[model samples]
Target: DKGELKGAGFSFQVSDAQKYGQAIGHIGKLTSGSLKVGDAVQADVDQARRQRIRLNHSATHLMHAALRQVLGTHVAQKGSLVNDKALRFDFSHFEAMKPEEIRAVEDLVNAQIRRNLPIETNIMDIDAARESGAMALFGEKYDDRVRVLSMGDFSTELCGGTHASRT
Candidate 1:
């Protein structure tokens, strides 16, 4: 997904011996500079790379649901990141998962994938989504309007990321 170098991450109070500027500017916005605000920035992503990432991203969601079902309802995703090579997921748990539990989660996910459940995306009120028992990431802030992704009746979550059309 790497594209043009649209902006730089700069810190004015760096520990280095010298300072480049007195103020820091945000991407697509002017913090304190002569540059005009709302500068148009365009980025092009490699389609093949994007496809791989999307596959991994969608898998991450299924894995989360599988973990919750295998481990316990207390399972909550702490963090996650997916790339072409791997999908890393962190969740809340007191102890390491047993081998059998891990295998069960894997089998469950494989079965779901084989079923080819259609992935549904919809925009709805955050409160309504919550009322329907859709799992929301703990401690994450959400606005009144949110995107909900449902992988059939297996998993439904409030997500804004891109996902595959089917499992």
Candidate 2:
């Protein structure tokens, strides 16, 4: 959500924020504005950019699951970046991925994509989410309530991002 502050300062909204803070509900960077606390907000969306990001984000999850399947359960995601062009994933691995291992991961992700698995989302207590076997990123903070994203029976993780209804 975004909006302009109606005043002499002429504050304009630049972009929406993702993660919430303790004091700030939504923290967005301003391009040219002098916004203050208690400013009213409105939803502003760029449909095309959002669509591309969604695709990349969902692909990141798929790749995460495929990595575990092909590599090992010890594989833990270190970080990830998703943009309109691609999704870059960094993970903890003992050694460089072998060619066959990389190909196997690709094949697994492709097979799931071909299946067109239904994407399911549910809001639940954080503890319940963990009990449900949802994979969560280490060091990431979670509230009492969390959103769980499950890709068919293939992947289940804690995420708060746009995703397609199907794989």
Candidate 3:
């Protein structure tokens, strides 16, 4: 591979990435030029976009704790989607959330956000994490060692996602 600038203003960006077996695949669109299998290239991440993603990811943890407080301990995370634009958290709940309940949850989350609690992450055995009351997603398998992310005493969960340094 030649150390050459292939093209400028080519509007090429990685739209999606996933892992299959032991390999990772980057899916993207190239506006110009053809690339051979071994062509060398540099990848730059948009730091601002990544910051937004971290903020949203951390917010989800706060929201989860708020939901449990307001909607009862039965609330369990079913799924989640986190990106720079937004975070969608799905959880188990029987009835539609009333407006007041929604507002209460928002207030609780906002209060924590205002505190700007420092985020802490620790790697420990899965059993120890469970004993520490770290919430894990149902039906999800985890290795013997796990990451336990905590935001003060308010929230703690088993997570492998990126998070902001503070609430």
**Number of the predicted model whose TM-score against the real structure is largest:** 3
Candidate rank order under lDDT: 3, 2, 1
**TM-score list, all predictions:** 0.76, 0.79, 0.84
User: Which scores better on TM-score, 1 or 2?
Assistant: 2
- Pairs of residues clashing in candidate 2: 2-42
Query: How would you encode candidate 1's per-residue C-alpha lDDT over 5-78 as one tens digit per residue?
Result: 23243212211121236553323322332323475533434557668878889998899999999999999999
RMSD of each: 8.0, 3.6, 4.3
**CA lDDT for candidate 2:** 0.83
Backbone clashes (count) for model 1: 0
Clashes of each: 0, 1, 0
The 10 consecutive residues of candidate 2 with the worst lDDT sum are 1-10
Quality of model 1 by C-alpha lDDT = 0.77
Q: Which runs of model 2 end up more than 4 angstroms from their true locations?
A: 1-18, 22-44
Q: After superposition, how far is residue 115 of candidate 1 from its true place, in Å?
A: 0.9
lDDT at 152 for candidate 1?
A: 92
